[model samples]
Target: MTGRLFGQGEVGSSDLIREAAKRAGAKLLEYELDAQFRCSGSDGFINWVDNTLDIRRTANVLWKREDVYEFRVMDSVQELEHAIRQKAAEGSARLVAGFCWPWSNPNGDGSLVKDVQVGTWAMPWNAKPDAGHLGAGIPKSNFWASDPGGLEQVGCVYTAQGFEFDYVGIIFGPDLRYDWEKNIWVGDKKHSFDSVVKKSGDRFVDLVKNTYRVLFTRGIKGCYVHFMDEGTRKFFQSRLE
Candidate 1:
């Protein structure tokens, strides 16, 4: 897998974490870098008639499960920042999960976000802020803000539903769902985008498309996309025209 450049001093995505925090100008409720593993195996194990066991080439099941070092609660913002900074710089990417107060997307551009190399980008499922005057459906998530300083420092979008950023820098990891047809995000089996769709219907789909749209549009003037599905690229090309 291709590695993403993140953080300060080639260490952690914390440079990004700090920048984002600064941009939002919000305090940290909590945050940390959590470790996880990408595991998969054959679902059905078949026995051979020859007194030996043969593993059939059945469907492959892949999923991310929490690995060693379960959870490390962060006390201060600096500690959380330092931990992520350290992880982003490591040779292998480690999973990190944490909580943050809430921020509003002031800009909402996709090109502005940067991709991280070492870890999956995740935020608190409940951190979503109220969409005050921005009006509903306009995308009031903090990920949609355009902070010139923040953009130059750390670029990427890593969060959940109901958010839009001026520059979305999604860190592609093993969990991403690939759709060869639409060439867009199919759905994360782990995160269960399908369930989100089922629960919210078109409203959910619209939020996803719009969330990605906001992510794609984050560029200062244009979008720089990498490793996208053919269908997704086509969708972008068609829409850009």
Candidate 2:
């Protein structure tokens, strides 16, 4: 599969996607975000004519925050599988887990590092379609028959909102806080600056607590968790105990 990996600022996600695609032999469908970007994630080839195609399926990777589109197209199942595997290998694979059952073996802790597919949230445990967490039918990927291997799982507090997992590894990205004095979440803010700044705004305490609760409860069997900051990590350690 191939497309113009469009994104403002630095190109981490787009670059990773492109490299992974190239490694897998998927062609890059190039088009400016401002221009009409298009592609089909199937084995059948897509012929882009200024912005037209003769394929059965086609989609646009339009971004919300930025006015950009990553024109991508896939050719074969083999290419799709390779691309997914490559995408999965985008980030760290260290299983950021919670304190629970299936993930009980501490020995397996470092096994998933190296290439982690950024799960629902920036965290790993929030990984979707996990053992028990996946709702019903598996999410349809552009390619491959199953979730690619090698990618790590990072469970986030929010995305794990109402779900459960048989075994979970939660990685607390730089996105949470706990008020030690009040025994509550200092505030609940997603990947926003308001979350880090004190007076930037009031912390969504209830939301934070509830979010953590959901993330913690996901482990029907086992869990392991990693916090991004020492402060949050200390808090999680105390709570886990």
lDDT of 1 by residue, 1-241 (tens): 2224332223445566667888999774444424211111111111110111011223322211232211122333234445544543442121121111123233243221222222343232211244234322333234323222222223223432222232223322223334655644453334332333436643543444443433333222111233223443343333221
Best by TM-score: 2
True-structure lDDT of candidate 1 = 0.30
What are the models' TM-scores?
0.27, 0.33
lDDT of 2 by residue, 117-187 (tens): 22322212322232322322222111111233212233333233333333334444344565567654444
